[model samples]
Target: MRAYETRRGARLSAALMLALAVGACGGSTEKAEGEKPHAAAADYERGPHRGRMLRDGDFALEITLYEEGPAPLFRLYAYQNDKPLDPKGVQVNIALTRLGPKVDRFTFAPEADYLTSPAIVHEPHSFDVAVSAARAGRTHKWTYASYEGRTTITAEAARAGGVTTERAGSAMLGETLPLNGRIEITPEGKSDVVARYPGRVVSMGVELGERVRRGQVLARVESSESLQTYSVTAPISGVIVEKNVTVGGITGGQPMLVIADPTQLHAEFFLYPRDAERVRVGQPVEVTSLAGDHRLASRIEAILPTADLTNQTLVAHVPLSGPTETWRPGLGVKGTVSVGANAAPLAVRTKAIQPFRDFEVVYAKVGNTYEVRMLEIGRRTPEWTEVLGGLEPGTEYVVDGAFLIRADIEKSGASHDH
Candidate 1:
């Protein structure tokens, strides 16, 4: 019985030794051979179910991949919860790479030419991507710039979301149609210079054909409400074309005297709905009064969207260049608006750019430097001149006090760097 018991103990000890030897071999294989039997299972648990988090500068990018139908679809999302991200200066690039033989060629949806492959059909595929761009400076500190002669707004809004009413001048993509325009005199704008509180005309400073400046007193009116005879100044300076009331006439709401600023005497031209589409609020126009001698230069102002029911025409206002004495209401005037082809080049404000002999020059504000660029020239009018070449659209160019900055740039030899 003692001998049988000792044999049983020896067999149990041998079994225990065999188990310890197997455990030691497994640990050695894991460390030196780097063979993880559970590696595929661990990757499957953590890879697709858990997304990859990526950070670039101030931007945070999150990419999630999940098996959808036949392919593993990836959904990419970007967030900047901690800080604001400027869209202007940021650029992103993405690439997909194949690791093992199982990985087929991968492709991006929506058909991007930059995509490397058609599609990843097998397992063990990886996507490598990066986000890189210049960080934009504070938008509020950006100065005023002009494109095609109009003002442009850049930078983020001073308010939370941003200024919705603000607009920036579009850069010139290519040759575009010149904006249609017409001109109007000052009195053409809406006004109510009626004799609302009229009295006796005590004095008359303006004559029938005299050109008056704005706010010039046309005549004086004396009423019980006005106390002593008070002067009624002209709301807009033009010419006193109509004198309805004499020195002693009692007046009420009727017009006491007709005062119209020739420059303000804008003619609201009724354009056919189709024709109006070619015209814009800032286009240049040539005005020829019925009298023929009164040739005036003007620009298209407001374009009323609603058409006249009776005339079926769109009404547009043209602001005249200067005060004129000849333009009067009911007097017909002929306006010639030049409608160019869609491929024609357009002019921008001359204030934003200056002429440098044969070439045009503008100061481009890049970083803290103002670089002067020589540009090609095109058609010219009084208000604006065309840009044939040199500057890109959407890029900020100094408009206000541009010449002063150009002088500074020239003095500092900023152009030497370029």
Candidate 2:
């Protein structure tokens, strides 16, 4: 992307390019010199060639510009009437007003063909250029826009072009540590229904996978020690995932059913060796389902006693919160834990950023005008990037469809360096 000059300069560049192309493809028939259009005396009266011109009685100063190495250079040509006048003791100063309501002023020194500004110029060339020169005990000032790399479209047209705007602002962005997690049974969520004493199972009331409440009779047994009947009850309220007792089998003190709370499944997030040191209890976490649709919020409640020797990854238990949809034991998940935060003075969605003029830029919308602004960026994340300069807070800018605007501006040739 390039910084564009004013519309007048753009047209002049196009005309110049067209002339060059036509000259390259000229036909055999040569027209007489008389057939060619000539510059009349009046053309010199206002000063010939490009630039903003100012005339004070007999003295005329025209400020023309051309790109040198990195940016545009301004030259001031002084003319006494229609003939060239030596700059001699003439002094010139130029003021450039750009976006952000900022101004850059440059003083000129006499060079070979014209007076050149001393400063190293840069892009975002579009601006209101004010030129003032003092000579012959008189001073003249003129103001004209060098509107390059800028475009204005009506709101309706912008809407038709799918342009959307957002105010530049600040946001809290945290450093994310990526993790892989899976739902599994926690010690607290597991319950074993066992016989208190050795007995012969007489009646079995509950089946496998059945839900039971605490103190509910899961089976009736005849105790061998006293030859009496006893009721075996569920110890915890949960789903009965396992049942091993038979109606006629004699028990030697063994578990009858295994109950686990499926509704509140235990989730463990695995961290690599590099991230394990930074992970701690109570750090914020986001658990996303493998489908990347469902999500639940939780924190690092505890680290598992052992690490996976095969992978060298440690498991952090993150008990999920709220109701879960399609979340079951052994379900794979993604975990993003926040280890630190970075607050920026200004930040925007990374999608809003575009490459322009060798810098990362986002189209800033000032009313109906969309102008290119070079940005100084800092720390960034996949979702947001920090804005260091070239933008102000509360300024509305294109956040969506900025790429389309870039295409349109390129097609318009507003900022093209001919």
User: CA lDDT, every prediction?
Assistant: 0.44, 0.71
The TM-score, computed over Cα atoms with residue i paired to residue i, of candidate 1 is: 0.31
After TM-score superposition, the amount by which residue 173's alpha carbon in candidate 1 deviates from its true location, in angstroms, is 15
Top of the candidates by TM-score: 2
Can you write out model 2's per-residue Cα lDDT over 1-418, one digit (the tens) per residue? 1222222112112322321111111001111111222242112223475554566666777767667556667777888775777776688898877765679899988888688886855556666666677887877765545555566666665665567898989987778888997888778778888887788999998888788888889898888899899898888788899878789988775687799877777678877788999999999888888888788778889986454487677789988755645688888889888898878879988888998767888888876678777788987876888888877788888987787656546655454321
- For candidate 1, lDDT tens digit of each residue in 8-76? 101112322311111000010011111223242112112122443344334443345445566545443
Off by over 4 Å in 2: 1-97, 100-149, 153-173, 245-250, 307-313, 343-346, 349-359, 382-384, 392-417
Candidate 1: where is the Cα deviation over 4 Å? Answer: 1-184, 187-206, 211-220, 225-228, 265-267, 283-299, 305-307, 322-418
**Ten residues in sequence with the least summed lDDT for candidate 2:** 19-28
lDDT at 186, model 2: 76
- On lDDT, the leading prediction is 2
